[model samples]
Target: MRYAKWTILTLLALTVFGFFHYTLPQHDIVRIVNTYQERQDLDDWTRIFWASPDDQATGLINRDVQFIQAVDADGKPHVYRNEDTGWSWPPYFKFDTANLQTQAEDLKSTAEAPKWVSVTHYGWRIVYLSTFPNAISVRPVEGPDATIIPWVNIVILTFLAVILFMLRRMWLQFRERMIDPMVEDAEEAWDSVDARADQAAAKARGLWGRFRAWLDTWKGRPRR
Candidate 1:
């Protein structure tokens, strides 16, 4: 019974911890990102932004996570929809590229790039392609070259590792607290516990390996 509960907890932890980073419009091959930073406050970790199309005061209520396209005009960035006229955002792909490197030294004085960032531009849209593990903000799908090396997946991997460790600890505690002293025939019960645990673990490992393998093979683009 305790093992069942612990198993459930482990599964739940993996589910929750799996959300290492926010990826929007998962159907897209490339994620859209903010290009012009002077007027934007992108929160890459959550893939949210400080401001939105309407209502820009001094609170977090205006934060938006949707992909946006830059209007060709030099006005403030607006909420671009699929139906918007001219320079509209598609389902995926875009970037803004106003890098802050030469701004500080020049009198033009453009907006500074955020403390941690790696940006790339795709026409009117911007894509944040990568960042450090502990950065506060990042572009949507913009960290650690996800296809080659999924850092967020690594975080989730660590989460699974910790969960496995805790489950092992719990199993040990369960044995010590519930089963060890209770069984009169210690030898037989011990043998049974060892056999059942080994079987269950082996089965779980095989299932996990198969699942991961299937996930890897699911990488190609879907048919139209």
Candidate 2:
């Protein structure tokens, strides 16, 4: 029993240590990839309306548009009074918010995803820079796209629970098998010992009562 308990404790410690060691790096990579993908999606939508067709027709450019605020001559911070909309730099194509979601997903599907290493500094950074003139494609990873994290968690948890449950059950079965005969033998031995002890206790109590009675009678005797 002691050995089994120690084995279980050791196994638990090993499992915890192994999890941190093996899974942490993979989880980090997945997180970085997901962040890049979401940002790319948002950027792509912005670009569709504003950027001119270029060598990279993905529709990203860095430009600012001036809007006519109160043209009277006051010019009191026209930026605030002016409605902040997409810059008036000549648009390449018609912008449609209704089709933005579809365009975003299409960009995700068609765009060659940069390698994980280059995603943050190169592609993702460029997307951020392009936000001035054009919207980067907004491919917000629709419905469990390109990720297995949740499914992997479920599978691993279920497998571990089953294995541990079976291990515990098997241990219990083995223990019951090993201890049943010993328990039966102890019960028989206890019965015999209990009978003898009960008889001995009765006799001792009777002898004690008799001795008290004799002392009381002697004390009651008259002097003459």
Candidate 3:
């Protein structure tokens, strides 16, 4: 049971960690190499990775998706899908897909004369699943080694920590003030019932013993 409890806790922690890792914004310092638009088929399970830019387009089987191609400081390639989240999960509320695509195009650079830029995005690039991280924003950086401070993630995580701490404190207070008193009262009531039952049993035994002694007197034996 102890092992099972720890296993459950471990799995729960991993799940929460994965959820935050996927949802929270991440940064990649890369040089934009290209930008293009292509028709994407969304009639499969991979649709979850894409966005619903239009409410009416939700039922559509396919749509045109813009993409940005870039390479990291190590010269490794990365592809990001440009889509509007617009009142959806992750809540970036991005509606500037065209503007972002233009920015990516303008920032395009060759291998020798690289103009490094930071791509702020969320999601994962799963090649096997044909899913790309959705790019949120793009901004130029001093160099590929620019130190970007993740202030947004820091604020969000700190706020969440404070909330969890407050909730735990509330739970502890409730247990101390309400639940503990009720439980103690129940235990005391049960103890009193057991005491009464023991007293009744002793009284019954005493009466039966006295009756036996009286019978012994009739038989000419001295009463006990």
Q: What's the ranking of the predictions by TM-score, best on top?
A: 3, 2, 1
Residue range 1-224, candidate 1, lDDT tens digits: 99999999999878764443232222221222343222333445432322122323334432323332222123333222221111232222222212222221121212332221222221222335321111112233332233334454467568989998999999999998888878757888899999999999999999999999998887775857
Compared with the true structure, what per-residue lDDT tens digits does model 3 show for residues 56-94? Answer: 468889989999999998979999999999898879989
RMSD of each: 25.1, 19.9, 3.1
* Candidate 3 Cα lDDT to native: 0.94
Q: Given candidate 1, what's the lDDT at residue 121?
A: 24
Off by over 4 Å in 2: 1-145, 149-160, 184-195, 221-224
Candidate topping TM-score: 3
RMSD of 1: 25.1
lDDT order, best first, reads 3, 2, 1
lDDT winner between 1 and 3, please give it: 3
Best by lDDT: 3
